[model samples]
Target: MDTPQNTALMRALTELPGPLPARGVIHIAIRHTDRFTVVSNDLAQHPTLSTVAVGLAVRIQSLPQGTEIGIKALAARFPEGEKLIAAALRELEAHGYLQRARTRLPNGRIVTRTVFCNQPAALLRTRVAAARPQQPPAPPQAPALPDVQQEQAPEAPAPQDHAPFVALVPPPTAPRQPSPPLPQPRELTAELDRAATALLSDLRRHASQLVLSESDVRQLAPAVAAWLERDTHPDTIRHTLTNDLPQPLRHPAKLLKHRLTVLLPPPLPGADDLAAPARPRIAVTPFQTCDGCERAFRAPTPGHCRDCRNAHGPAQAAAA
Candidate 1:
């Protein structure tokens, strides 16, 4: 039975890219299970992390603190190169093993930094945290009033005065004229109306079995307009609705509406689909070599490999 840890280890080891044939020599970095932080097996089962991503997680866990790492550098070390590395870095960042941000200094210099982590930390950001909204102060309480009665105190005697007055009524004003009606907003442009009619005509022409009423065309017109608003070509819309339609259709309009609303791809962002600027490539390892055995390790160790450490007698003392 293969455990999750063993499976992940085997996967990382196998997926790492082979060195170029004429590169003279290939350098491999090794990590001891007892030396560095232990990663959870749950990361291997992560939905977004690919094989390359798993490899990267293993490599990154062995790196020293504050070691400068980048996608380009990791790509060089991993198989299938740049694009794969870029995607894997993105996956790692999403999973909280890595964070990247572009920072501007007081001197107006801007720099991009990638942070690698053995544990989850707060996400990095180029923008500062939003200031919390200020709360209003509580209203002051009113003083309590004692009960008093003015009605029981006193009453003045009433005096009578007699006078004759006549009532007057104002003349009626002339009848008001009715205001002119405001023009209603046009729901569809003339070109759009024409295109919608053309679309309906094509639908009726191709799927003659579908019974389309006037109301059905009216309802489907706006949906077609929405697809056009999303930058779908009118001809493409026409063909999509017309082709691959089921024979002896019961409700054509409903079917087309479902496809138009549900199947439409979201509008692409300008140039690239990503919301942030593309991350630049950086080196993943610090490139340190052991002093005793002359073996290159992912990060700086105690000047020796595990074998050298044991031979040098420090391992036993450290254990003690």
Candidate 2:
């Protein structure tokens, strides 16, 4: 077993003939000592998310709170463009990895609050906890007295009918009024929808202040389509949305939405009649016998047909 030839053969088998050929994928992982993010495998290897979405989610999780993750900002930072970035954000939101809520501050300014969840399960747990009913805390217990002292304590007296009673009423809270329902758009065809979307997207060309995000375009597209459905011109829509610009307009989309809803024109008159199938018209011509040749001919009234009238002289026709 310890023969020289056997030892030589084992050394040859263990030694490489050259550098090993690269195969599949190999990872030379480096442990991060700083500026590293911890992402859940559930998110990193999500079955339904695209690669772009996963990367975006990871980027969002690594950022500090209050960091701007808007579509425009992300598009500027990355090469994916606004549409793709917006789609990725939507994917994250749909999968419960992100949440954006619009809140009105005490200063009467509306702002969006974004919440990012590293683990979707954590988000679900938060929602469940918030929805659960909370039990009241137990009242403080009275200290126990000595056995002999407790037996000698005086008994409490009950209230009499002559004594005045006061009810413990809770302080009144401000009532919350429900927000009015948003305007709904009429049914739209593909062409109409495209036209509406294009119009909304092109608003910035007319007024730079009217620049809208991709999501704003989508949300307002239907309202624009409703205007188009009523035969409103694109120029009219653009003018209505862009005219009388407010100085330092904070929310263009909201202003546009209000204008589109409030200024919507009624459908053209006889539009239903035009859409309905027209009744087939039938000519009810009366048959007449010509006195000249005793030939039957069709006429609106008791008169000769075109040929008979032409053949007859002008004077004779007038006399007849």
The reply for model 2, stretches above 4 Å from the true place, is 1-23, 126-320
The C-alpha TM-scores of every prediction are 0.28, 0.36
Q: List the residue pairs that clash in candidate 1.
A: 70-282, 72-281
Residue 308 shift from truth in candidate 2, angstroms:
99
- For residues 139-198, write the lDDT of model 1, one tens digit per residue: 998975644753353548777753322212121343665633311213566767667766
**Residue-wise C-alpha lDDT for candidate 2, range 1-320, written one tens digit per residue:** 57998787666655746564577643335589999999889998899999999999988888888898988888888888999999999999999788876654554345777878676675455556555799899999998766874557686998675422221222234376564443555677898879988998888999999989999998988888888887778998888788766667898888887677666677877857669787999979878887667788886667666776787768696899
Model 1 earns a TM-score of 0.28
All models: lDDT?
Answer: 0.64, 0.77
